[model samples]
Target: MEKARRAMFFLLLLIADFSVAQDTAGEADEFHVGVILDLGSLVGKVARTSVLLAAQDFYTVHRNYSTKLVLHVVDSAGSDVQAASAAIELLESYKVQAIIGPQKSSEAVFISNIGNVTQVPIISFTATSPSLTYNSMPYFVRATLDDSTQVKSIAALVQACGWREVVAVYEDTDYGRGILPYLTDALQEIDVRVPYRSAIPSSATNETIMQELGVLIAMQTRVFIVHMSSIMASLIFTKAKEVGMMNKGFAWITTNGVANIIDSLNPSVIEAMEGVLGVRCHVPRSQELDNLSIRWNRMYQQDNPYESPFNKLSIVGLWGYDTIWAIAHAAEKVGISSARDKQPWPTKSSTCLESMVISTNGPELLSVIVQNKFRGLSGEFDLTDRQQLKVSVFQIINVVERGWREIGFWTVNGLLRKLKRDYSKKTGQASMLDLNPVIWPGESTEIPMGWEIPRVGKKLRVGVCSSEFTEFIKTYKDPITNATTASGLSIDIFEEAVKRLHRPLSYEYLEFDTADAPISGSYNDFVYQVYLQKYEIAVADITIRSNRSLYVDFTAPYTESGVGMIVPVKENVNTDMWLFLKPLSTEMWFGSIVCFLYTGVVVWLLEHLIGNEHVHVPFSLKQLAITIFSIFEES
Candidate 1:
């Protein structure tokens, strides 16, 4: 009797468990998914909470529809191997419709493989490693940025701070290693010179760091860029402080860098880390986050309830959260139905969901991707190309006193214009270039690095105007005799400059003849005589005006004297009248026009001629200019 009673209870228990399992399995025809993640790390945990909360909100608001969402969670403990195992199990065994959250690069790489095999869509929250989509995983997508998007920004910040020589210390893994090539390409494209880089192993020691630091110090490295863990950053900062370098002032630029380690920091640590500048691609201040912070603080008493204690770790983490929300919102746009009571929810496999992807790769899909603009929680997001983020936004932030202050925002065109080539093409002013080409801010590579040693040669004879107020260097007789050698400040500068360019230099005293020689004719003779490889180049303190740029290329000018008056500085002189009135000065301006038209014809005629100096100097046709200038004025 007792055995029969026990059997009856066991049978009822089995029946109840079977009914519950049946409901969950049969409900799957409505979209279901698996979220694979670490759930332990601060970034992972925050991402997990946001997605779950969002999905809950998405489903509850759409209950009028028959659609249902069931999400299964899988913990990988931040291991790629485990993440892959879990992802495969979801695709093959449980057969989820799609997946989200392979929060780091290593796992994302392997999980991408499962998406390929099963043809289920997968999107990642924070895997920025390059070559992401090429894992034979056409079905995969990333909800985060590519590795190189803000590398130029990071390099710019470093260059802006005038940290010319840097030492790179990166983690050995894919996340850390991925930064290597892309950041290097960015640095190189900007022509920045990096002296040393160290690829550190995961098991790096204080001794290894010390050895590398010693090598860097030997090379005179003053800045350190730590591109690894917070653990690594804290350790290096502590070591730097111990080495007395931090206190004595060494620049610390962290890549994905940090200002202070909040949870791990003490009063002394904050003081030690004060001067460190971390390079981050800052997000524009979002009204959504501002509002969220207000509500979250009132309820949870935290800056970011969904974020870690390092709440403002970077705008990157917030952007990641926004990426997931953006995908959901875009899904709503395309999957939405007009009938409120009979709408269909977006399945993870829905064709409507596929149409709105802004990052779908392939030559054909580029136009479609560009057409969609997503409104994310943080801000709007779009893609201009496969690897490029089209958002024209960023800021340089200086973190201080438990908050951040804006250093400035980087507008796309504004920054480019700042770095646009220094030539006068864009500035519309030749006068500016003639005066100053490279602005040496009391500091610059005044002499380029590794300046080439000059070749020894016979002294190069160069000529300049000898008029007292001009660039002409005078010659002096030896005490009693009437022979001469070169002597003047301009002469010295030209001589030294030629040697700087590895050319020989000699000087010829050009005493201007009493007669006014036709300038177009005389210049032809000067080029044939002075510039015929006899002297490699000339620096005559001559006003290039305009005609010279056509006949000969001028090295950046050495000196420019504004039109001067022999009258005393104290005297009242109508120099304005003298400027256009002096026949010699007017010729200097007008002959420039004559030479332009005449030189081209002369150059073309002389090109293939075989005679010694076959090109005849063209006489200045004053009739041509007298006609045009008068016509231009009248018109």
Candidate 2:
């Protein structure tokens, strides 16, 4: 009977242990994470696929992890209000520990504020505005580079290509406008000028884009640095091509925002962007990346059946995939737990925002995420600085037929260098020769001049003047037609300058000469004519004077001017033996000696006659001569 009692107790203990084991096995931690994106856009679609795939792949590899990230995605639908609403819903309803995306920089602004209030970490792989700083939003982490990081590379490219001036064509949103200041400052550092900033609204119509392009084409500046979204960029380039602005003289450079997604742009857009140079983040090719691309292409096609089959993964997608891994690693390391059961923080019922509860695991999770370091598909995924990705290298690509070609690389240290070569940190201006041969716009091999001669308005009125010095300028009249004509050095130089413009310049030289046939009015009056808007330009033996500069601008003086005197070179030299005597005539010499003798006599007489004993002298010719010589010396 005692043995039966012992067996029954042992069975009861075994049952208790089994119950505990089953409860533990069934209770896997679900760490809720929110994802907000513009599902209607191409970038949004690609990022979504990459994020989902990354989560699946990471879990498949690390099945033993106690914490599982449960993603709750919400479509922002490309609206900032919608994105904000989505963030609030995720925080209030789902009680997410973290949030990813809210794609655009403008959209990230308000949503990031929400993250700060809730103490929930918000990580973004796409929003790259420099204004979204870590200091302002402590809970927000940028998994990709700030747009400002690549501005230096763009400036380097402009400098290397010898473009002195560029027009910044950008969308008038935070994402587009944020980089302008940095780009302008960088270009200024290199002595390059930002002549104009063309800010196109993101919602601008095709006609509006074309009108802006027309204004750009009419201006003298030919180089355009486009900083805008891929959609706007596509329309802009297409309109530019239609307007004949993609000719040989024009240069177009796109920032990484558009460049990174070049593969996903349609063939028509790619064709329109031919000969365009672009700066993009360089992701080193690897076997893992290749496999990701293959899988991504297949899965993307399956998910987006109606979309074009040619769509491929972009750099943003890589960043999104890497971001998932980063978050997952941080989650497992910090061991995040469900925060729903925690007590709600004090509130005043001042809207749903006030009633939200703060996550208990957010601060620790954020710390781990910012400190996480690992090799990701995009590059070194180190966010230890808690600001943005460290962008050391950027690829310089040239758009060609069907695809783009890698021409060179721009490194934070090396500036610019050709592919397949190791380069040291360099100082001074980078040269275009470091890159491979570039096929410029209109399929021309020649580098663009970055400017054009003004073609609008009436032909330039060039006033020519005649001078007495025919070598400088000569004006005359044809006896048969009585038409005025100009010739000589000034005419030749002016014509040559016009010829070198590479474009046709319609100009007629109006001869300004006096009726007496010597020359025109004073140069001051001729220059004043230009200032009065009578003549567009005046070419003659005109001197550049400070007084004239007040009214009219002057080209650099082609001919040096100043007062000069030329004396004949003397050949005969005076080698007379008595050259010293040539300074005075014989009569003059005798006169001087006589005067000295008279003066000596007067002095001697005064001494002797006055009975002064201080004067001592012998009554001899030698004494007399000495006295005269003394007088001469004194004189």
Candidate 3:
């Protein structure tokens, strides 16, 4: 009886051991993913909800996978330090396979650096700065389109409308500055000039924004390309309208940062943005996206009951959703045993210090993630070799009274399509004319010329050379009035060119040298006055020579070219007694009389030989002589 009891106890112990082993294996299949976000911001809220929903949906459809995603959420509190702390915690404590969020580019830089050392994949959906390039951070994956990608489209729009110059207005941040170089290059490629860049501090006050706008308003550029956060954009437009910059002839263009979130703006903000044009990422519509949008809206409304109805989900949210699913798909492909390996913590003396935990599975997981491609809510979810989401289409939206309206779409090939009907049938080159009619600033349909004379500023100071030689450039002063006037071929050409401008240009001509004397310096010195900012332009017989052009811009040459010597010649004497006889030398005068007699005799002989009735009547010697005399007289 004792042996039987011992065997039964051993059998029950074996069964319990097997059950514990199965439970351990099941736990190992669950992969941990960390989410670091600025939950205090509206974008963060939407992203957070989208990620959660994505994880739920991914697991439901992918139940057969050997690995499951277990998300760990942390709030960065909109602080870079907090984001770093959260990343460290998620990396060291939870040992997550991958991390997402820290929406801003500045925040992403900090976390991505940590991710590089830790060998964990850091995915960002909203950090669109070009500075966050994958070459710098191999483990970093940008699930959103880089800001630089949209610069070409913006440049195409500017070119199509024939805007000569553009002024970029951006926030003074990494996100804002990163796109400037690309935007400048793209604009230059299409023969557009970026005259000035207005950078507003992220924390700038309303007064500061207005001051910047005032400076822009006082300049010649009327076309403004705004590349900043939506909040800053709203303030800029608001202050612009307050200062009357929203009037006719002014143009405003925005990138996706502000354009994609137009629906979330307040009515007052929309009103301020009236007549503004913008570019937004284009996501193809599908049944799955439609259902997802409806679900996201309901969930957002439930999350924030005090806020107005959530009508649309931003591209960032869609990216968030897609990022979660991508992580899950990648994790599943990597398998449980390989993904759940415990990473090694760095030694005290290691280069990475306390932040040194190396993930054994990170490289493999990243490789899988980079290769993962699928159709998601935002559109096709293909990633470039750098792991950036491939975006080839963008919509140009115009701000109207009813809100933003789609005017056209910009493709990667640099074509603009007006509507779905046009896009489906589009062939050949795209043009600005293909876009829906735009209501320009001041509620006019006339296309803006993209420049205007400053309404409030000093008149342009034109430098004129006071010449001792009055033929080329002359300056005169009225003795009693002391009013200076300048007139010359150069001045006439300058005035004609100015008159050809679509608007009046206010200018005041200031003599570079005193009117009492000729210019003291060479022509180059006069032209250099423009470069020295002493004058806005120098108008004279300013020769467009190679040396002069090195210092200042020159208009097309208006005067005849080439050089000729003007030396004095001795006057001829016409009143001399022998002047008439001087026409012939003594031998030449005698020779000329003999030759005339010979010619008259030859003519009379030819008339007698070849002529008919007239010659017959003149056959008499006296008549022939008379005819010869008449012929000589006629000659």
Candidate 4:
């Protein structure tokens, strides 16, 4: 009886195994997709996890779908050449219908070319250089906002803070340099000037970065706009803090590239970045997003245990998550297959890249991806122009403590106190005050002036005139100290003007007199001293002559110096025919005579029309004259 029972159990197990195999064979078709990323980098690690999670969650929600995306990830290891190589390998070996990333813009350039040739869709969620556009590469699609799209918001912030000029500090790479032209043009539209551009190579040493920063410190501009990756930005801020550039009277603004991933920075890096203002792509919060963030943290921690525990998910990760959903949806619509039909190459070549087959369903898939619209984890995801997703809003953030705080939000219209509010015409345009109060560098609440008097370790040279007329400019010397003191109207006026400046002005007076020379130079030579750069400015009782105006600018005369004419007045009136005309000017006399004639003509016409007695006069001239005399006498 025991042997028979054991045989029946073995038979049941065999039957179950056969049924499981049959069900797996009849499951949904697997659609192969490739993902290329820098697995060693922070963004790479976060994005890879998000992409995996998105794929798993998508299939679980839509199990009835006909197709499933099977992702094949490759580690480009942060190299452009490697990215391109990985793309070729995926296209030839795996025959992937779509490729997700080549993290950096510099890497995307080469990989995108590969996709164009293969007729496969290349979707990048983090490569956001404005130089790469849809019009040029139709097979490439950007799931992220272009770096140029945030320039207007930067310009608006500059304008609101009343900064006249700014210096742009960027990495000397394609991704860093791509947004400069657009940034310069946007600032110019608001009447702001970009005085200088400071480019630092990605491979530059700490000493090299310090040398470059030292040059910026000697300039007059105190405002700086930084555009670079998070790693490079961390080094910049650390150096800036060391050099005292992150103190009071200095302003810094960061582009979205750095701001989006600020949450993932190390605690030490965050401390160095305190009191910095940033603009990031706004990701609307939802229940689904909240749940994803929880799962993402768990999965990321499990994968990367050595990374900082404080590191949190950022918008870049969210973009990576949404990007997969978009591709998966498009793949299903196009009825993609792992074994897609490939067109024969015209001629076989030596290189694998040249000999790769073109995907027949690539163009159809590209069209579907661009036209796909849905509310994603990172807000509304729509790639309308096939180049980039439309970005209408950006969140303004301020780095503080171990994290950052939301100050306000920027929209297409302008800055807003709240993201969603009643926008009347009068209240549409918000000023800097609309944003929450900020604690600037040095932990001060005062807004920076954005400009400073150049600190060149020397006082300004102000040349004063030593004239015979002590009332205008007088010089007194102290016998004990051998110090020369300037007094009088011009000296007092010039000193008062200096006091009214936004910042303190330090200057030393040098008398332009014969104390050092045999003979005193004329006023022309004194003003010419300024033109020769011997003196930064000249203060004296200077005349506003046209010749003197050519060399140096002169302030408007505070005290009058020109000659005034005085003539005798004749009060006695001579009795003559012109004496009556003296009361009214020549034009007024003519005007009064014309008015009297017009009044007389109108009265005469009225009497004739009404058949009054004034019309019975046979002589027309006599009647007109009588009417004129009567009207004038009545007036």
Candidate 5:
């Protein structure tokens, strides 16, 4: 009887062993996620790929869960109709317990509406539309920055760059549509504004959208703040080039939506992206982000899941790893994985979000992370008093050669060059060059209420670069000293102008004997000739180009002199009227007539269009057009 019982037990054991193995293999073959996607059609593909990889790699290593995550991808594909279809599939067909995403808010609303009815919690990775959280839509949670935090962070971003104008181009979906008011309000505090804005629809093709980008090109807005996701942005850029609207001077900026696939950065795209400025909660990918990358890279490299030709791939890959770490913070502490043997996992569910930090007695497990600051590759994901993510510190990045460089270098010669009292040093070698003393937060200096040239001798030789000076010299010599004062005037007049500084003034004269000489060309030749150790102070009404300013010391010019386009008196018969008019005299009278008419027309147009401020700068299309036309005429 004992032998018979043993035989029966062995037979039952054998049957169970095969069944368990078959189930394991089946689980390994598939993983699932509940995803909702709409207007972010193209980005949905990439994001879904990333999430799928995360699920797959995590399962491959540890087999603790009863079932492996088989990402049940549901695509709204940027359509309301399709969004509803995808949502029904995930809820009914997949029976997924926890959902990962509905990428855009337009489609996300449908998921939110069904949340309480279905009792499934939705964890959104990138749905930033404003309407998502309104009216206490239960069962909704976010994994990415919302439009408010995004715009506020952007406000900090613009403040960081000291930029005043940002051009925002957005699609008319909840994702883009919901952001403008908050963006405007946030920027208003920082004194920054969306000067030129365009609203595009998510359905617009590349060609349709690129036409709008042409206007950005014409506006020449320096900072381009794009509220678009990667898909539409990639389209706008491609079309911008196709329509001949791309230029090197533009500064392109975008939200974190474009931060994911940074590896798309390559010579072809990056070269044109020199001034491309974008924002990402993702820690700007660097060699620092790579330590985590090596692990995941070994996991999925076999599949070539990434199609990004840009090195930005390496960055996003590392940041994605950071995402895993962030999840580990929650899951390993509060979800199915938190080991109770350790300390508390903070609030077991979302209710404890207020305490920002999650602590556990499983120090070894938590210690595997926790030590290196709260920074996840996406950025420092610190919590606020209100259970919100605070990443006020933003990293502004520029696309470089197959890589990315932080937008402003360790140097400020680029961003601060425009301030009058403050300036940039050309060599970037770090020497103070501001006419205004550099100030620290606690210190103050008396700005030389202004600078003055102390009175000095008019006998000094000044360096000069105008042929007009030479022309005057040829016709008449100072019968006293045979020195030719050019433009039929005394260099002493220039000297006298400097003496008004209420300080000792010195006068010097320099002559440029030719035309066609660049200020750089002339200075190099002149400096090469003079030894400045002696009475070598030189002065001229030399137009300062940054390069030339470096080699010599120049006093501020009392008058700016440039070669005026000389046209022979013709056509409207002004020559007869000008026979008695000498240069300055004629310029005086004709200038008045021209100036009055110009001012009158400008004021008239301002009143005609933008309604009332007659003396205001041109802000309307018609006024701007007239101003531009007049500038062309004047030029």
Candidate 6:
């Protein structure tokens, strides 16, 4: 009986093994997804980890699904050519249906072109240059918000703070240049002028950054908008602090690139970036997100045991996490494996000349992905018509002593109070009062005037034109005191205008004249001096003409609009017969004589007809006219 039971058990095990083999063969369909990233970069590392974790989590939830997602990640090594090469290899060799990444905007440009030719979707979470739009490359989808969308928010901040002039300090790469036109347009809409643009190269040294900082410090504009990666921004602020440019009068603002990475920075880096304001994507807190955060930290720590814990996840990582799910859901929605196999995958030799390998299911998968909408780690997962994230809310944070603090929220409508539950349900205005009080540079609570005249070291070199007419502008030297003084109408007007400024200004009056008496240059030459930067500004009786205005800017004229003519009035000395008729024309004199005769006849006729006792029948017509005239004079 025992031998018979053992034989039955072996038979049952053999039958179960055969059934499991058949089941595994039936579910052999694997969807190959490729990832192109610079794994050496901070953002790239986070992205790679996020995507790996997402795939793990996705399979765990949908273990019974028909197809499984197999990720084939390739390191681009932070080079554009390497990124493109990696993408081509994945498409031709691995037959990947979708690609995520090539973190930089420049890298994405080349890789996205390859994706278009291959009919594959190139989804990028951090390549935010506005130039990478879906209009040109239909297969390119921006999983993250475009950098252009945030320019309006930055402009609103500048407008709300009453900054009349702003200077943009950004990297010289495509990531920096792409958003400049949009930023300028937005600022122009709010009547703010971008006086200067300081473009620093990505590989610029400390000395170069300091040189740029020095140039900005000497400028009159104190409000600066810094748009660059976190590393470069840290260097800039460090140099700014060293030069005393990050003091009370200075204002610094950054974009999402630097802002989103603040939590992961070292304390020393954070210290260098103290009092900097930044705009970051607002990710609403949720239970699922919290759970994911915990799981991600554990997995990340286990994977990278030597590195420190990040403690916080950026939107870039969150977008990566959600992108994998989006692709998975889209792939599962179209359950036909024949759809992916219908189009022939090209070989290395076949695509050597053209590099074209069309994916049969690319369009359908993209359609489903575009249509897919759900609450994701980075808020709502919806793509706009432009194939970019449909996010509107952005948080304005201030870098303080203990990491960053949320000061306010900015949306398409305007700025709002600190974001909370159901915050999107309410609308708000772009007013400073709506936001929490910000501790600006120098740890001051007061709002900066946004401009300052260097108090300690530098003085404005004001150019004053020496005039032949001393009444307009007179410069004299005291014989004994050896002191220079300037006085006159022009000087008074300049002083009064300076007094009316929002803040105090220190200026030294520099008379632009030879050792001789009066200035020799024309008004046009005098104004050109300002353009050449020989002097900060010129104060004189400078006539504003169209030609002069083309070379340099001019303030509203302090004097009258046009020239005034002054002439003496002569006494009237006419001794002719027609002199009496000078006041009344000759026609008027003739008409008055005829009117008297007609009035006399009419008065005599009326007196006879009415039979007035005062005017007897024997009364002459002239006498009746005189009586009528006397009555007219009295009444």
TM-score to native of every candidate shown: 0.52, 0.81, 0.76, 0.83, 0.50, 0.78
After superposition, the stretches of candidate 2 with alpha carbons farther than 4 Å from their true spots are 1-27, 336-338, 341-349, 413-420, 424-430, 454-489, 501-536, 556-562, 566-572, 575-635
RMSD of every candidate to native, in Å, equals: 21.4, 8.7, 9.9, 6.6, 28.1, 7.0
Worst 10 residues of 6 by lDDT: 421-430
The regions of model 6 sitting more than 4 angstroms off are 1-28, 339-357, 384-386, 419-430, 454-459, 463-474, 478-483, 487-502, 512-635
lDDT agreement of model 6 with the native? 0.81
| Residues 489-550, model 1: lDDT tens digits | 66778667667753233444433221366655455444444435554454344456565555
lDDT of each: 0.53, 0.85, 0.83, 0.85, 0.52, 0.81
lDDT of 4 by residue, 1-635 (tens): 99999999999999999899878865888789999999988889989989998999998888778889999999998889999889989988888999999899988889888788778889999898899986778788999888988998898888888888999999999999999999999999988999899999999899999999998998889999999988899999999999998888888899988898898888788888888999998887888888888999999899889888766788888888888999889878988553466885554556655658888998888898999999888888888776555678888999888688998888876777687785532221247878888888888798898888767656788988777677988886677986668999889899989999999887888777645543234788889999999999998777778888899998878976767999999888697877776878999989988998888778778777888776776868778677877687767
Over the stretch 1-635, how does candidate 2's per-residue lDDT look in tens digits? 99999999999999999999987885658878899999988899999999998998899888778888899989999899999999999988888889999799988888989888778899999999999987888888888899989988898888877889999999999999999889989999989998899999989999899889878987878999999988899999999999898888999999999999999998999999999999998988899899999999989988889998878988899989989998888888877544554556666666767767777778888999988888888888888877555677899999998699998888865555564676776644445776778898999998898888556535668887877788988887788986668888988998899888766777766766555532334677778889888888898888778898999888887786776999998789789899999889999999988986689888777667877554455477866666666576767
Report the backbone clash tally of model 1.
3
Over 4 Å off, model 4: 1-25, 337-339, 344-349, 425-430, 456-458, 468-470, 474-487, 510-534, 561-568, 571-635
Report the C-alpha lDDT of model 3 over 486-550, residue by residue, as the tens digit: 99777887899899989999998887655344444456687887899999988877657787778
Alpha-carbon error at 94 in model 3, in Å? 2.6
Top TM-score model: 4
lDDT at 267 for candidate 4? 79
Tell me which of candidates 4 and 6 scores higher on lDDT.
4
